[model samples]
Target chain A: MESNRTESRENRYLNPYLGGVLLGLVVIAAFYTSGRGPGATGALKGLIVTGVEAVVPEAAASSGFVAEYREPLPGHPLRSWLVFQMMGLITGGFLSGAFAGRLKFRIEHNYRITSERRLLMALGGGILFGFGSQLGRGCTSGAALSGMSVLSLGGFITMVSIFGTAFALAWFFRKNWI
Target chain B: MGPLVIYEVISENINLLTAFIIGTAFGWVLESSGFSSSRKLAGVFYGYDMVVLKVFFTAAVTGMLGLLFMSLFGWIDLSLVYVNPTFLTSAIAGGVVMGAGFIMGGFCPGTSFSAAAIGKIDAMVFIVGLFIGIGLFGAGYSIWQELYLAADMGHLKISDSLGMSDGLFALLLILAASAIFYFAEMVERKFASHRL
Candidate 1:
C-alpha cells in the first residue's frame, strides 16, 4: 500500500494552468534579460556546428550554414548563449526529476510497440523536426511559443501549420501512441 | 531600461548566466507539468489529455499579456526584443513537416531535452537523430536555399497584418483561448475512458 501510494503520488504532475503561468514568467524573464527568447534547437545547432568545425575545418568554413554559426577568432560556438541555456535545461530537468523521485533510466512506450520500434520512430521524427526547424527558422518553442507572444505573423503561421498538420496526421500514427 | 543586456546594463557573461537561470526554470516547469512524458504529450492529439494545449496556449497568452503590460509601464523596450521574421513558404512547409514529426516522435526539441535528462532512452535517441537531421540539412543547404529564403516577409506582427490594435487582438485571443480550453476539457473527458 505504501509503495502504491508513492507511485500514484509520483505520477501526479502540476496543474496545467499553473505550469503555463510559470513557463510564461520564465519566457518573460528571458526576453527581459537577454532581449531574446529561449530556444532548444539553436543550442543543438551550435553543437552540430562545433562538431563540424572540429572534425572538418575546411567543410565548416565553406558551408554557409555552418559559417553563419562560426564565431570570431577568439569566440567559439560552444560558448553561445543557447548552448549554455541548453546545459541549464538539462541540469534543471535533472534536478526536477530528482526532487520528484522520477529519475529512472528506461524506455517509455505503449504496449502496442517494441522499444526498438519506438526508438526508430523517434529518430525519424527528430530528423523531420530538425530539418523543419531549420526551414521554419525555429522550432515550436522558438517560433510558435516565443513568436506568438510577440504577435509575429510568421509565428502564427508556423504555429497553426504545425498543430494543424499534427492533428491531421495523428490518426495515422495513433497505433504507436494510443 | 529593459533588456538590460542590450542596453549595456549587464555584461555579456551576466546575460549568458541569465539564460542558464531562465532555462533552468523553463525545464523545471516543463518537466513538472508532465512534458517529459511522450505519452502525455501525444495525448494532446488523441484527446485523452489536453495538458499540452492548455499549458502551451496559457503560457503564450501569459507571455503576450506580460510583455504588453511591461511595454505599457515602460519596463521593457519592445523595439529591442527579437521578433521572429516570417518566411511564408518555409513557415508553412516547415510547419507541416514538424507537425508530422510531433505526431511521430511524441516530443519537441525542448521537451525531448527535459525527457532525456530524466533518463528516457527514447528521448536521448531522439536527440541523436536531431543532430544527424541538422547535419543533413547543412549538407543539403544549397538545394533548399531558395525554398528557405522564398517569400521574404519582414518581421510582421499578426495584429498589424489583421489591421487590429494589439490590445484588441489580445482580448480576442483570450476569448478564443477560453473557448479552446472549454472544448479541450470536453474532449479530454470524452476520451478519458479510452486512455491507456
Candidate 2:
C-alpha cells in the first residue's frame, strides 16, 4: 500500500507547459549551432551501421544506414555527434531523476494485466517501433517533434502518422497503460 | 556568413562540440517536461491529459517562430537549415509502425532514455528492444530497401510546395496549434481526473 502511494505521486512530473517552453529552447539551441535539430533514431542508425560493419563490412557499407552515415573523410560513424547527444539525454535524465529522488526499477502497468504481459507488449512494441524509426527516417523525437518545429513537411506528416496510429492502436493496448 | 561549417564560419571538428551542447539541453528539457512518464505521455491519447499535445505544439510553434525570426534577423540562413529529407512512402509507413510501437512500448527513443533515468524497468526493456529493432533493420535492410529509397522528393519544405511565403506558412501553423491548444485544455479537464 505504501509503495502504491509512492508510485502514484511519482507519476506526477514537472508541469507540462513549462516543459514545452524549455524544450523549445533546446530545439533553438540545436538549430543555432548545428543548423539542424535533435534526433532520436540517428544514434540507433549509427549503432546499426556499426554493428553490421563489424559483422559484414562490405555489405554494411552498401546499406543505407551506413551509406548515409559514413563520415566524409577520415571520421568514423561511431564517433557521431548524435550518438553523444543521445548519451547526454540518458545522463541528463538520470541526473534530474536523481535530484528528484524518483529513481526505481519497476514495470508500470494498469491493474488489469500482469507485469509479464506488460513486458511482453513492451518488447513487441519496441521491435515494431524500432523498425518504423528506421523506415520513417526518425522516431517521434527526431522526426516528428524536431522536424515539425522546423516546419518540415515530412515532419508534419510523420507526426500525424505516429500520434494518429497510436490513437487507433491505443485501445488494443489499453490494458497495459490505462 | 553563418551555419559556420557550411559557410566557412566554423571548422568541421568544432561543430561536433555544438551538437553535444544541443543534445544536453534537449535531454534536459524533455525530462523536465513530464515526457519521461509513459502514463503522462499516453494520457494525451486518452484525453485525460494534454501535456503531450500542449507541450508538443507549444515547442513546435516556438521553434517554428524562432526559425522565422532568426532568418529575419539574418542570425542564421533559412536555406542552410536542414529540412529533413523526404521519402514519402517509407516515411508514412515507418510512422504507422512506430505509432503502434508508441502505444505498446509506452516510450519512444528519447523518452525511453528519460524514463530509464528515473529507473523504470519497463523503459529499460523498451530501450533494449529499441536496439534490437534498429539492429534488425540493419541486418534485414534488404527487405525494406526499395520502399525506403523509392519516393525521392528531394528535401522539400511544405511552404515551397504550397507556394506560400515562409512567414505566412508559419503563421498558419501557429493558428492551427493555438486552436488545438484550446481544445486540448478542455479535453484535459474532462479526462485528466481519470489518469494516474
Candidate 3:
C-alpha cells in the first residue's frame, strides 16, 4: 500500500490482517532467501556489549554476558549481520514515519498521566522487558512469533507464557494503557 | 539441500546484506501498521484495541502456513531451519516477566525500536531500560547461570512434541489465530475506550 493511501479511522492503521500478511511474507522471504528469521533484541544486546567491550576490554572479558563477545576466536561481536539488519529496521521505520508524516518528537502516554511520568514508567517497563528478554532468550519478535512461524517449541511456549502473563496482569496495569 | 546460505549458495557477506534488507522490510511493515505506538500495541491486554491481536495472529498464521507450504514444496529445507533451544524453566519464567513488562511498557523490543525511530521518547527510554536490564543480567549472569543453562531440550519443533505433521500443526495454529482475530474484534468493541 502507498504511504499516502492508508486512511485513518479511529486513529487509522493498516488493516491488521493485511499487515499480518505482509509481515508473514517478510518472514517467508527471510527464511527462503536467507535461511534465518528476523530478530530485534539480539542486535541491541550485541550493540550494548560491543560498546562496553570497546572502552573496557577487561570488564567485557570478565563479564558473563559480555563473555558471549568472545571477539578473538568467534569474531568481532558487533560485526554480526543482525546488527546491520537492526540498523535497517531503524532506518526503515524513520522512512515510513517521514513518508506518513507521523514522525515527531514526543512521549506517547495515557491522558491521565504526564509525559514525564509516562517516560519514567516507560523506562522502568523497559528495564523489566530488557531483563525478561534475556531470560526468555529473545523478545516477542525473536522467540515467540517468529519462532512459532517455524513451529519451534520454544517459540510457542514463550509466546503463550508472555501473552498469558499479560492477560493475567492486564488489570493491574490498566492505568497505563487503558 | 536448502537453506541457501547453509548449503553454501550464498556467501556470508550476502547473508548480512539479506539480513538488512529483510530487517528493513520488517520495520516498514511494523511501523506502517501502527505497531510502533504503545497505546495501540498494548491494546491486546485491554479490550479496546485489537490491532496487536489481528496483526500478530494473522502474521503468525501466514508465516506458519507459508513455511509449511514452502517445506512441502521443497523451497526450503524444513529440518535446516533454526529452532531456539528449549530451556523449559527460563523460557516460561522469562516469558512471564516479559508479559508484565509488556503490560507496563506497552512495547516489545521490536515495536519499541519502531516507535523510537519516529521519535517516541517513551520508546527511547524503554530502550535505555533494556540496556540497563541486559547489562544487569550480564553482570549477574552467574546467579542465573545454573537455571539459565539447565534445560537440554535441543531445538525441537512443536510438531514433534505432539507427534503431528507440520502442516497439521500449522493448520491448527491458523484456526486458533482466526479465532483470536474474531474474538479480538469483539473484545475491542466491548471495551472500546477513548484513551487512544
Question: Which candidate has the highest lDDT of all?
Answer: 1
Tens digits of lDDT, candidate 2, A51-96: 7778898886677666666754236776776887888788788777
Measured over the true interface residues after superposition, the C-alpha RMSD of each candidate is 0.7, 1.5, 1.2
Best by TM-score: 1
Two-chain DockQ for model 1: 0.87
Tell me the spans in candidate 3 whose CA falls farther than 4 Å from its real position.
A1-10, A69-73, B193-195
- DockQ of candidate 3? 0.75
Ranking by DockQ: 1, 3, 2
Off by over 4 Å in 1: A71-74
DockQ values of all predictions: 0.87, 0.69, 0.75
Sort candidate 1 into its docking category. Answer: high
TM-score of chain A of 2: 0.89
Q: How many angstroms is residue B147 displaced in model 1 relative to the true structure, after the best TM-score fit?
A: 0.4
Worst 10 residues of 2 chain B by lDDT: B1-10
Error at B182, model 2, angstroms: 1.2
lDDT (C-alpha) at residue B171 in model 1: 99
